[model samples]
Target: MSRFFVNVYSIWAAFWFVFTFLLIFPFQFIFLQKEAWKPMAHRCNRVWAHLFFPLVGMPIRVRYEAGKPDPNQAYVFAANHFSYLDVASMMLIVDTYFAFLGKDVLKKAPLFGYMFSKLHIQVDRNDPKSRSKSLQRSYRALESGRSMVIYPEGGIRTSNPPQMHPSFKDGAFRMAIREQVPLIPISLLNNYQLLPDKKNMRLYPGSVKAVIHKPIETKGMTEADVENLRQQVFDIIQKTLDEYTANPKAHQNEFKRLTVI
Candidate 1:
């Protein structure tokens, strides 16, 4: 499909998905039992992903270093974010129970806003207090055995395509070490390829690819080791991305459809 058609379909599908979710899920969400929302919300999100990806004509594909992560264990999934699709497509790969530490503006999105407030942890970067609160909430979530999805680069701030921003925020790594959870380096390799972070709501005809790198165990680590841990994940993902840039064809899939529970 052409770029024009892809953009048109994406805009149409996004609004439509939000409208449908508003009608069906908002009532349940408003009264969602706080402690019981994980499984309920995760099921709803998977349904949304199944509907949107096919509706927008974008196929999903995944490349896991190991087959997949154990659903029973909690993890801190750190990925590079370069496209709006990064968050949405995460549902296709992460089948385990997890919530994301996302930007505060995510709550302003139509139907997702309500769900984000109830199900995910949101942080306001400008406010030190808010960031502190979100970090506390994230630590509690990890302690309670719920995994988290965090972007190490913070957001899609890189000036150059496919290259990570020069540095990363310390929040994700800090919590991982303090909580002693395995941090999984996730590389959303195809998000920028399928949709560049440009001014327009643009898309392209392509398959999605995410590399779930081997988990880095943070046992017996402290705040002093945060940057070293951050750099370790950054190097692994950036190296895989650089290899993809050198040879994209090897990663292409003709009929492989990624499955997530």
Candidate 2:
């Protein structure tokens, strides 16, 4: 818990992360062009996250409140983004043939950036042309039977740390509505504590707890229902966060909920 310990851990984490990247990314990059999407789409992400968690000393546990996601089905997952570690945490949940609808800027990040540019849907939000291309790419990914993960908040909207952003953007919901994919809202309860968005970085060894909520159906949803569906997903994720924050111990165990929204 000391600053010195956290500093020491960060140094170790950086070395291990780069080491793991060197070990895994080359094959992932090669397969992105050479193999089918399902075979290579999430291979590096899953492997990198599995390696990153231990080096950072965080045991990220994914609890299925509804049940384990169906590998055979595709989904549009919208999760709360509150920390630098959120995306890494997300990689743990997306176990099936999956790709992320992530920011275009992420593709510039060193070795992993090449994977982002090639395998995932990268959106430059400021450019209308880029957004259109990204949307089309997302639709194609979904239609091809590969699941996709999207942060509906549009890249860390809440500047004041861990609270849910005031409102959700509709690109992710709109994609689900138009493409008719099931929407799953993910609750990343403690990712912020692991790595906050602050000037002074404090990386530490901690548990990354998360909830895999039931997939909210968007089968009959239209453009008009985007707000309603977005609100519903936001509420589901926010409420779980509130519960976990109020009594961390009460919600530690893996949960199972029979209800589907």
Candidate 3:
């Protein structure tokens, strides 16, 4: 709770994070070498997260408002961005193979950067050319029947906790419509509280909770529907966050415990 303890715990968590990644780096490197083996490299990421989170005392739990998703189907997943921990927490959310559409800055992170650049799609949000190229890559991935995880807020630009950034970008919605895939909305209920986007980057150990809403069907939808669909997903996640902020305990027992160990 104190600043000193928060710093210490964060440092400890960071240590385990880097250590676990090092253990799996060789396998990931090999898996990333061939296009056919990229999915295996993503799974290695999940393994690393499972090892790091528990060691740092963060257990992940999920509750589905709708039924669980079918692993065989491809989907576009959109969730609010609030903390660095959200990246790792995603490995716990979707069980099947998927790639993340994250900021290009992640491509610069030490060992993880190389793996991410090869295994996932990265975009420079500020550059029109880069965004267009990333969207093309995402389209190709969807066409190949692979799912994608995108933070519709673009990045963690929110200064407020529990409250999401007012605008949700249309990229996720457009991709879902164009690909004729289901768009899944997720609410990361408590990540910002556990580990916020701040300069100091302090972290606390606790149960990370997420709510996966029912998939919004995009079949037969046109480009004209992108705005409505984006707003619809935003409202779903924002409403869930409001409810959790009002009564966090009401949703705790509602979630089925997901075993990470």
Candidate 4:
């Protein structure tokens, strides 16, 4: 059944890809040239996620508790990276546009790479120049009323016991402090369940939830504040995942009960 869904979803996704390319691609080019492209890109991402993976029949629903930073305000939105779907899921409720700090290697992918390139600040982790350039671009984006979404844990990790890459990078937090933007630490739970690290394969229908925590204000903060902020964000995500993994049913019911418009 899972394999069946994967096949069906794959075909539908192909059709949708071609359709979007034929219809929306030109507009995407236009939007890319605009100053307000970030939010527009995010809105497009949400629609693509819903329509692209049809085999994953489960709908993508995002519920969030409002934070201190207004959706209108720019932020450095950081989260743990788990799967490729993370980008799509993040775009659902985040009204503003955000630029992701992605590895340069992903730019080589075919059609998907084009979309990623438009929205990402490509960084060659091994090169100092690439890292410096990405930071500069991110700051400019923030100044332009756009947010930067970073996966502080570095790369995707898929395991029963999820472990963050040792020592979260301080670049993002440092930028937030310098720019005086709020640091929004998002916790994504069960996204990996929907689409685990399947090499050369796809996944079946399953729910993906991204819980957004309150933004951590960086007003008057400095480089000294980065570690504390990083640890706090890490703890929140770790604790949330621990709870969900322990009793998914209980947590899901509780989450639904608490979720109100």
Candidate 5:
């Protein structure tokens, strides 16, 4: 199919899927029912992927590393932020129940805002109150056996080999220490290929990979240990991504579909 037809189908599928989800699932209290929400949300991602990408012809290759951590254990999932699709990649790859620590502005988006508000940890980035509230939500999600996926870099990058900004904030690591959950650093490769940060966007089908680096045990670590753990994950993701840049085929299997253009 032509790119035009694929883009058209992507939009239609997204609209119909979100509309159908809302028609059946109530808008309110989506977070309250974590048990049902986790699996349902993952299924939503798969459905959307199959609908717009595979069916529409923008093949999505999602390469996930083998040996995922057990779902029974709650974890603090930290990932690099690139595209909106990162959330879906995480859900479809990671089997555990989790919620997102996303921007406060997402709560105001048209269709996704309401849904995102469900398990969403909206952060103001500037306001102390919003940060406090987001931290509280993160703590609660961890306590409830749901892992929290937080993007420590804050937002998307302006260039390739995106600088990670700085060491991660103490919030996620601190919570992991207090809650005694392991910190899992996840990396999403080529998610930006599907939806680049450029304006006037249309979703393209491509391979997306999420690398689940071995867990950094925060069991006995203190708040001061956050930076060290942060670097460990940063190094692993950075190094692996650099390697992928040299040889894209090494991680090609992550893409469930191949024909992106």
Candidate 6:
């Protein structure tokens, strides 16, 4: 696609994103009014994502290598962070209700930020106190049977596409170990190409592909195993990402055989 069309499509996507959020804001606010209604607020978020993506010409396709997750179980979902699209794309991947451990900067994004602050756990990674508080909240969420979506790369620090940042944080692994929940590794195959992390924020119309690997059971694991567990999840996601990146045709073909949600 030409630069002109990319810019036009990006703008079109952005407009629908904001417009849909605004359209859903009233329902979100009402659903968020009580503690019990928060899950309904998350459902509102999923509805918003379902509306915005197709309206912007992007369809989400996910393949579960080990089969879909059990609805009754809670998991710690860790995925590579490459683009802004990862956040919304998550809503499409996991059907069960969960909270996101996102950067505190999301709390500054106009009207959306306010809702995010109330619904998700935001952390200032630079602040020790804030990080501690966020982790505590994450622990409580898991204790209450809700899952969490955490980017182990710690916020898109990678300069190269498909290649992850060198280090993975121990928070996600540690929390899963402590909570005795299964940890699921997810690979977002092509979000960076669809919407590159750039100043211009250009978006292309294409299918958003993701692979949900089998969950790694953490029951009976101790804190000493954090490093090994983190490395395991990282390797699983990185290998899938490298495979798909090397064979774009294979990636495209795989999605065609699977249903697009």
Which candidate achieves the best TM-score against the true structure? 3
Which segments of candidate 4 are over 4 A away from where they belong? 1-22, 34-42, 53-56, 67-69, 158-161, 251-261
Q: What is the lDDT of residue 80 in candidate 4?
A: 79
Order of candidates by TM-score, top first?
Answer: 3, 6, 2, 1, 4, 5
Ranked by TM-score, the better of candidates 3 and 5 is 3
How does model 6 fare in lDDT? 0.91
lDDT of 2 by residue, 1-261 (tens): 788888988788778878887888777877887546436657667877777776666676778877888999988888999887887767776678777888889989987888778777898899999999988988988898888888888988887655788788888899888989898889888878878777887777777778888888889889999989988998898888888888988755564322120
Q: What TM-score would candidate 1 get against the native? A: 0.90
Deviation in Å, model 6, residue 11 alpha carbon:
1.1
- What tens digits encode model 5's per-residue C-alpha lDDT throughout 1-261? 588876785686577556655553453335336755555754554444444444434443444454667879899888877777776556555666677888889889775676677656789889999899889888988898888888877777536644455556667777888888988777776777766666766666545566677787787887788777777777877777667667778845444432232
Cα RMSD, each candidate: 2.5, 3.9, 1.1, 3.5, 4.1, 1.6
Candidate 1 local lDDT, 178-234, one digit each (tens):
999999998888789777898875667667887888888999999899989988988
Tell me how candidate 3 scores on lDDT: 0.90
Q: Count the backbone clashes (under 3 Å) in each candidate.
A: 0, 0, 0, 2, 13, 0
TM-score of every candidate: 0.90, 0.93, 0.97, 0.84, 0.79, 0.96
Name every residue pair that clashes in candidate 1: none
Candidate with better TM-score, 3 vs 6: 3
Please give the lDDT score at residue 116 for candidate 2: 73
Q: Report model 2's TM-score to 2 decimal places.
A: 0.93
What tens-digit string does per-residue lDDT give for candidate 3 at 1-261?
Answer: 788888899899989988999999999999999999988898898888788878887888899877788889999999999998898889978877898998989889898899999999999999999999999999999999899999999898788878899998899999999999999999999999898887777888788899999999999999999999999999999999999899999866779766553
Query: Cα miss at 131, model 5 (Å)?
Result: 0.8
Which pairs clash in model 6?
none
The candidates, ranked best first by lDDT, are 6, 3, 1, 2, 4, 5
